[model samples]
Target: MDAIQKSMLEKIADLHEVPEGAYNIRSNGALAGRNTTANIDIVTKQDKPGIDIIIKPGTKNESVHIPVILSESGLNDCVYNDFYIGEGADVVIVAGCGIHNCGTDTSEHDGIHTFFIGKNAKVKYIEKHYGEGDGTGEKILNPTTIVHIDEGGYMEMETTQIKGVDSTIRDTQADLKDGASLVIKEKIMTHGNQTAETNFVVNLDGVDSSANVISRSVAKDSSKQVFNSKICGNNKCYGHTECDAILMDNGHVNAVPSLEANDLDASLIHEAAIGKIAGEQLIKLMTLGLTEHEAEEQIINGFMK
Candidate 1:
């Protein structure tokens, strides 16, 4: 572990203790400059990494890229060199960031993150956005991820947030080739006077390509959230976009999910719903002796089900 990576690890809680073959790259610098690579089993974290993870076939020439970034712009202005994936490789990638408010007013904190994925590679990417401690509500976190999948490749992307002092916006784009597949699931929970916006776009460029998008969010207190998702298909492809949101007292939610197909041989579907906890179901559970909060929690958990 280098000094910069060690320092970056200090900012994160519950660092996973790595085994012998697991690789860890730590960084406290801007996401553009902290790029690293891995082949077999690897683990890494930093502020942000500008590049993509490329997995190669066979044990000798496995390719990978890791970068950590922290930006003051707060907008989605990020860059990465091209990432390459070998003909056939299997891998798991987790990328995310932890931002410190440091008393900065909200106006200075708007930032966005972007990613690009390669072909014929299998990647499971996990993204986590969180805060260090109590801070002012002026910081904004905007992240955008774009992925391109090749033939016979698979990608799974998921996100989790622990609330923010300010508003947040997240975007995702996945482009898949023939015989490729992408599954995206996003989970978010918010508190305080914060607002969150998320957009998901997937494009199927090859025959037999498939995509699935699922979203779940909870709004509490005086908060707001919006989710927009789109699935595009061509050349006999298959795609689906589904979104559901839950709102609490004084909370607001808006969800728009759409699917567009330009080819007659393509198939697409879109579904979205916005509502609060099911009162009737909660009451029925409470009648069985569960407390109100407990019933609500059970309902929320069941929503994910």
Candidate 2:
């Protein structure tokens, strides 16, 4: 890998070198490397342009990384990845994409990921999207994620896209069975006329099922952002969603959050807030020997963190 590509790996996957467990690295529309452990298997799908990740029943404390990188300009790539988590297994899945475009044509990547979690299983999924280059070409990403949780299952998702990406559209949805639960935390930052749109929907479809979705974003320098989320409680369940954002320097942000409750025992709620950074926050940080720009940076960093 080139230094630029390796640098991208560090930012997107937290990998300084080849990881210890199961992993698949894709670069420039092809597979760069792959490995599988005893409890997990990774296989390329014959009918599609992606892979399937399988975690065996009762597997615990293991992880898999599938990170894709693009360096060529005028390239548009798409992939489909499916995950099957076995019953009673507890594991982590790390997946992200990085694009480096240095030409006048657009470089884009679209990934669709689906997860099927078995009964009593617990899974943590982390995904980050990043782009870097000094070219006029746009860096674009569109990611779609779908999740299904069985009875007694739990799933947690942490997704972030905080730098360099010029345009992105992220869509995520989940369905929970009886006694299942889901939690999603999303953070995004856009600058320099960039644009971002995010949509999340979750369904609490069984007794005692629950879901929580939260999004926080910062937009600067005429960038535009949209955060839209909906939670539906169809049975005796609970659902909540929230959206918070900060805008600066002609930036624009719109938040639309909604909820629906169909059953008598179902409870659903939503909240949204969009505003600029507080002057007091900037002042307090600036009093500690920091410039105005530095203070604003610190505040924005803290808010997204």
Candidate 3:
């Protein structure tokens, strides 16, 4: 691996070597890599910006990793990845994008991922976005995700943007069938003059289907964040959405959570809260011999995790 690739892998996956039985994709024009596994088929489309991953039926305990690295600045990369999960398959995907820019120009990555999960399948998807540079350049990411779950299928998605990203706009939508469920957890922290906005829409279209969307964020040092989530239920289903944020030092946050029920048997709920750090919580940590800064750091870490 080159210096840029190694740095990105370490920061995103924290691995010295790729896993033994996992498929890997590096977005900087490197060839896609995959292990010798019969449970999944990995294919690279000749005319597209992303790969196609198909999990075999009855497969279990499979994992896939897709990470992007950008070594230069003033570059924009857009990718469209698709996943097809077969019936009765259980799989996990770890995907993220990291940029290492040292120039005075901006670098951006726009990724659009779609998933089609078959009946009785389960999928867990996790993605993290990170940017690191010392120059006066901006690192931006715009991600759009769409998920479709068949009857009796389940999907859980987690996305995080810890720091160093200058701006981001994320959009996600999911539709659930009968006896299906969808859960999404989003975590973000921004400092300096960074800004982020996220929107989520989920539809429960069948009986006994459920959807839950949650977001936790921290903004500091003149940063700004906005979160909007809406859930709609069309049948005998359940839905909930929540957004919680912490603001510090001139930071701003706006949260709008909404719910819609078209059927009498549908149930939906939403909650949102944005505030500063609690003084009592900090004082309690300080009494245990931790400095104020350390206490605050600990609390932030715990909260983000």
Winning model by TM-score: 2
Best by lDDT: 2
- On residues 1-305, what C-alpha lDDT tens digit does candidate 2 reach at each position? 99989989988999999988999999989999999999999999999899999999899999999999999988899999999999999999999999998898999999999999999999999999999998999999999999999999999999999689999999998999999999999999999999999999888998999998988899999999988888888999988888899989999998888788889999888888899888998899888999999999888888888
- What local lDDT does model 2 show for residue 195? 96
Worst 10 residues of 1 by lDDT: 17-26
Give per-residue CA lDDT, model 3, range 64-155, as digits (tens). 88777776788888888899999999998888888877899998999899999999999999898899978788999899999999999999
Query: Candidate 2, which segments miss by more than 4 Å at Cα?
Result: none
lDDT, residue 167, model 1? 69
Candidate 3, run of 10 with poorest lDDT: 27-36
Listed in order, each prediction's TM-score against the native is 0.77, 0.98, 0.96
Write model 1 residue lDDT over 1-305, tens digit each, in one string: 44433333334322333312323332334332333345543222244433333344632333232323232323233433233445555555454555554444432223233333445667676666665434443655566677778788888887776555366778787788899999988888777778888888888889999998888888888888888888888779888878888888788888877778889988998887788887898899999999999999888777754
C-alpha lDDT score of every prediction, in listed order: 0.63, 0.93, 0.87
Q: After superposing candidate 1 on the true structure, give the runs of residues whose Cα lies further than 4 Å from its correct spot.
A: 1-14, 18-54, 59-83, 102-119, 302-305
Q: How well does candidate 2 score on lDDT at residue 289?
A: 91
Backbone clash pairs in model 3 (N, Cα, C under 3 Å; residues 3+ apart or in different chains), count: 0
Better of 1 and 2 by lDDT: 2
Global CA lDDT computed for model 2:
0.93
